[model samples]
Target: MNAKSSHPSHNLPSRRTLFTAWLVLMALTVGTMLAGHVTSTRSLGLLWTGGLLLISWAKARTILQVYLNLRAAPRGWQTGFNITLIMLLLLLLGLYAINALGLIPR
Candidate 1:
């Protein structure tokens, strides 16, 4: 049998794929910084905060799929991880919204 067929993690991503993923991640990082206004003292309102959260979710998914090689795992595993990440991000956004709305005291 060929080496690929014999390997358990046979569907590893190619170098080109890795490079592309890296580029996408870098671009998302820049997007996050811009959306969050990292270089400025300005506060990010609800919409910008949501955009930043979405960017972070994308970055996390990319790292999990590409860097951690979770893409080669079973579909159930992928779904589970995705759900977990989504829940976590939702929780963070909820907290941010509450604080921004002055529901919580400083």
Candidate 2:
């Protein structure tokens, strides 16, 4: 097998890959949101949000693990990233729960 960096299987960044991935993700997210609006279904909003979040996260993780090759990143970076992600998720959940319970006027 070729060396890691030189391997065709590698997904390292070269500007083009990053730009294309970003465009595709944005397009997909926008399309989902538009479809949700057109359908007039509240569940569609939830679906759009959940799907976009999942796809966005997967793209970021791939960029980090394959492109940046940060699987071997410093432990502190990994821990910090996870903690930040967790906190953000918790905040979103709290907001959603509050809205669902009608505790907040939305």
Candidate 3:
């Protein structure tokens, strides 16, 4: 490998980038709390639940890419991680749907 490629700073995110990512994660966290109605007794309907799930997916992606430094990984690795995350989220959503439909005993 080249000397430049071996440098630690090569794949590291800058402070500004990390700060921006932090800001985004915080915002998403607030959005999640709001969407999920953490402060209210009201239950979330399907639409709200879906929205919350989407926000959660976004937050997970941000954590994976920025905090975990997956952005610097190979394209195949990135894609694989993303696909796995998506599949897991989809499975959760599917189970929620099935429960919502009364397919399973409460």
For model 2, residues 1-106, the per-residue Cα lDDT tens digits are 5477665345445687667667776776676566446557565444455554555555555556545655566677766776666577657756665655678766
Is 2 or 3 the stronger prediction by TM-score? 3
Write the residue-wise lDDT of candidate 3 on 1-106 in tens digits: 7888875447888899899999999999999998999989986876788889999899999988888898988899889999998899889888788876678886
Misplaced by over 4 Å in model 3 are 1-10, 104-106
Off by over 4 Å in 2: 1-40, 43-56
Tens digits of per-residue lDDT for model 1, 1-106: 6877866487789999899999999999999989999889977988899999999999999999998889998899999999999999999999889978889766
lDDT of each: 0.91, 0.60, 0.87
lDDT of 3 at 2: 89
- Provide the global lDDT of candidate 1 against the true structure: 0.91
> Per-residue error at 86 for model 2, in Å?
2.4
Model 1 TM-score, all chains together? 0.87
Model 3 residue 53 lDDT score: 90
Candidate 1's displacement at residue 61, Å, is: 0.4
lDDT of 2: 0.60
Which numbered prediction scores highest in TM-score against the true structure? 1
